[model samples]
Target chain A: MRVPRPNRAQLGAGALVLAALSVGRVVTEWLPEDPSPVRAFERTTTLDREVHLRYGNLRVTEVDGGKQLATSTSAMLSPGLWVTAHVDFTPTVDKVGPAYAELRDGEGRVLTRGSRNVLECKVINPGISGHCLVAFEVDPTALAGSHLALTVNVNDQRGDDMAVVDLGITPAQVATWKARTTPVELLMPKDAT
Target chain B: MAPVGMDGGTDSLRATGRWGRARQWLATLTVRQWLLAAFLLVLVGSSPFGGLRAQRAEATPTLSVGVEQTVAPVRLTVTKVRFGSDLGVPQAAKIDGRYVVVFAKVTGTDEKRSVPMYDALRDLLRIEQVPGVTKPFSTDPEPSSDDLRPDTILVADDAERMGDLAPGLTYTLAFVWRQAPGQPVPTSVRVAAYSHTFRQASIDDTYDWRDATRAAVGTFPATAYEKPAAS
Candidate 1:
C-alpha cells in the first residue's frame, strides 16, 4: 500500500544516462555540415585601407598589370590580360594557410591567378612583415568593376577564420597595367630580395 | 532486535545464500565469457563509430582518369593515354626509362559550383606505376604543345598548365611522367587527380574533392615500353 522511492544507485544511474544524452546532443548540434559554422567567421574588408583581421592587417600598396605586362616585348607571364598587386601585410598571430589573392569581375565572377603565372603573394608569418606581389589573369572587360581580394586564413580547430580585403579596380587603370611589361618579383615572407 | 512477526535469523541466512549464489555464478564464467562481457561493456561504454565517421569525412578521396565523375563542379575524363619517349614532347635530358603521357579532358559540370583552376602541380596529378599502388611518380604536364621539341627533352619546370575553367567550358590537359630507367614498366598505370573544389561565389574558400569512393579512373593495360635506343 506504500509508494516506492528510488534509492541512491537507481537515481545515480538515471542521472548518468541523462548526462550522457545531454553531452551527445550538444556534440551532434555542434558538428558542422555543408554550410559550416566556421564560415560564420569569414570577414571581408575593403582594400587600400588598413583592415584589421583576426590574424593580421592588410593593405594594397600598388596594383599593376595590363596589356604591357602580357605583351611579347616584356611578357612576364603567359599571354593573357593580367593584373598584379603589391601588398603589405602583417600577421598579428600565427596563421595556418598561405595568404592568397583572388580577382573578381564586375559581374561578381572570380578570377584566380593564371596557373602558369609566376607572381604569387604568399602568407606572412606572425611578427614578420614584408612586401609581396599577387597577380591574376582576367578578361579585360572585368577590369572596370573588378575587386582584387587578399585573404589570410586562420586554421582554428573549431572552424576556419579568414581575413579578406577587396580592392576596387578601374578599367582605365587595367588598361594602363596591361602596358607595364616588366616582371615584378614575387616576394614571399623570408625570401631573399 | 527482530520484528514482531518476521524471523531476523532466517532473513539473514537468505541474504547470505543469495550473495553466495551470485558470486558462484560469476566465478563459474569462463575466460571467453569474461572477454565477451568486456567487449560488450566497451561497446556500450564509449561508441567509437561516430569518431570513425568524422575521420572518413575529412579524408580526401582520390580522382582518376576515364571515369566521368563530378566532385561538384569539376568533371574529368582521361580520353587517351600514350607512352613513348617522344610522343608529346622530347625529353630535355637523356634518361634510362620511358615517358608516360596522359591526355585528360576536364569540364565544369555545374553552373552554380566552381573549382580552382586545375594545375598539374597543385592538383597533385600523378601516375602510379602499378595500378592502385600509392607510389606516385614525379609528374608534370604539357598543357600546350607549343613547348614540345622533337630534338630536345622538354623541361619539366617549363610545362604549361591549364587555366581556371568556368561552367560550359572544357579543356584537354596533357600530363607527362617519367619511368626511371631500371624500373619495370608498370603493367597498368593508374592516373589520379588530387584536386580541390570550391564554390563560384566563394572561390577562395576551398574543400578537397570527396564523395566518390574510388579515385581511380578505369585502369588501362600499360603500353609496351619501347626503349628509345631500339628505335
Candidate 2:
C-alpha cells in the first residue's frame, strides 16, 4: 500500500490565500502611509541638473520653479538631461562690488565655477536700477524624464526655495496627458470679497 | 348543485400526488447542484437576493466618490507681483508679474488640484485698466483648468497669452467639487507668501546686462507652467 497525499489540505490552503487577497484589497484604501496618487518612478535617476543665483541687477529675473512634460522620445538612457533658463535684468544703479553666479547639481556639487559682471541702467525704480542678463546651464547626465530643481545664489542670501519645473523630452502627444493634469481654479470677481 | 362529474376525494388525491412528485425530484438532486439551483433562484427572485447580498454589503462598505458634483465656485487670491532689477524684490519678476513658477499644495480628504498661474488667477486677473482697447481679454483659461469641467470658448480675435497680463493686475480663481455637490462653494483662500532672494549681475565685465534687459522688454515669454500636486 502507498501513502496518500493530503490533497484536501492543499486545497484548503489555496482557498485561504484567495480569501486573504480579497480582504487585503478591501482594507488597502484605509492605509495612511500609501502615496496618495499612483505614480511611475524609477529606482535611480540617470540625469540630474540644477541652477542657482542671487537677487539684484546681475541676475534679476528668478523663476523659482517651472515644469517639463514627459517626452515621447526614447527613454532608454541611464541618465540624460538638458535644461535652459534665461533671465534679463537692467542695472540702473552701478554697484562697485563684483557679483558671482554659478550652476549647481542636485548633490550640492558645483558644476561650473561662476562668472559675473555689472549692469548699466539710468532708470532707478527702487533704491536704484541697472540692466543685466544671465543664463544657467546644466550637465546632460541626468534622467531626461526626471524633474529639474534649481536655486540662485548671490551675496549671502541664496534663492529662498527651489523652483521646480518638468522636462518634456517625450513626444508631443504626451502633452495631452500633461494638459489634463493642470489645475482649474475657481476665482472670485476682482471686486468681490 | 352536484354535477355528475367527480368526487371531492378523487380531486384531493390528484393534487397531493403532484406535490409528492416535485418533492421526490428535489430530493434526488446532488447537494452541490441543489445549492447552485438555490443561488440561481435567489438571483432572479422577487424578494431581492434573499439574505446573502445583505451580509456582503455590510462587510464591504464603500464610499461612492466622484458621483455628485458641485458647480459652486471656489475663490482664491493671487498677488499682483512684478519683479525685476527695478522691482528690487529678492527675486526677479516677469512683466507678467514675476515668479516664473509657483507650486500650490492643498491638504485634507477633498483632494488638491494644480492649474497654471494664469488659470488660477483668471477670475481676479485684471489688466490694470489699459487704454485704447475697447473690451479687455476675458480672465479664463483657454485650455480650461478643469479636466472634466466644460470649457468656455473664446473667439480667435479675443485669444491672448499669459504674458499679456501685467503687474498690479489683480485676479481670483474658483474651485468646485462635482462629486460633492452638496458642499458649499469655497469663498476665500488664505494666502501665505514667501520669496527666495539671490543676486548675480549678468555682466561678466563683458556680458551686456543692459542689452539683455532691452531685448526682454516689449517682447514676452508666453510660456505656461503647472506644478503637480505633491503626493
Report lDDT (CA) for all predictions: 0.52, 0.27
Tens digits of per-residue lDDT for model 2 on A1-193? 2234669889899999999998998787665542223322211111222222232232323221112212122111101121332333332333322233333343233322222111112233433433322222222332233233333333331324333334333334233323343322112223221
Residues B163-213, model 2: lDDT tens digits: 111111112211211111122222221222211111233643221112111
Q: Poorest 10 consecutive residues of model 1 chain B by lDDT?
A: B149-158
Tens-digit lDDT string for candidate 1 (B1-231): 333235556867677777777877887887778889998887776675652223544544444446665544466676656565444323223444565666666665544323444332234345543321211333333333222221111112223344455334355655555544444556566665544444223465345343323234355556743434423
Model 1: lDDT to the true structure: 0.52
Predicted complex 1: DockQ: 0.12
Chain A only TM-scores, each candidate in turn: 0.58, 0.25
RMSD of each: 12.1, 23.7
Candidate 1 docking classification = incorrect
Off by over 4 Å in 2: A1-7, A19-193, B1-27, B30-111, B115-231
Q: Candidate 2 — what's its lDDT?
A: 0.27
lDDT of 1 by residue, A1-193 (tens): 2235799999999999999999999997887755445543546666577666666766776666654333222233334455666677677877422355456666666555444333344544676765666666555665567676555532332344444555567767766766766664444446513
Chain A accuracy of model 1 expressed as TM-score: 0.58
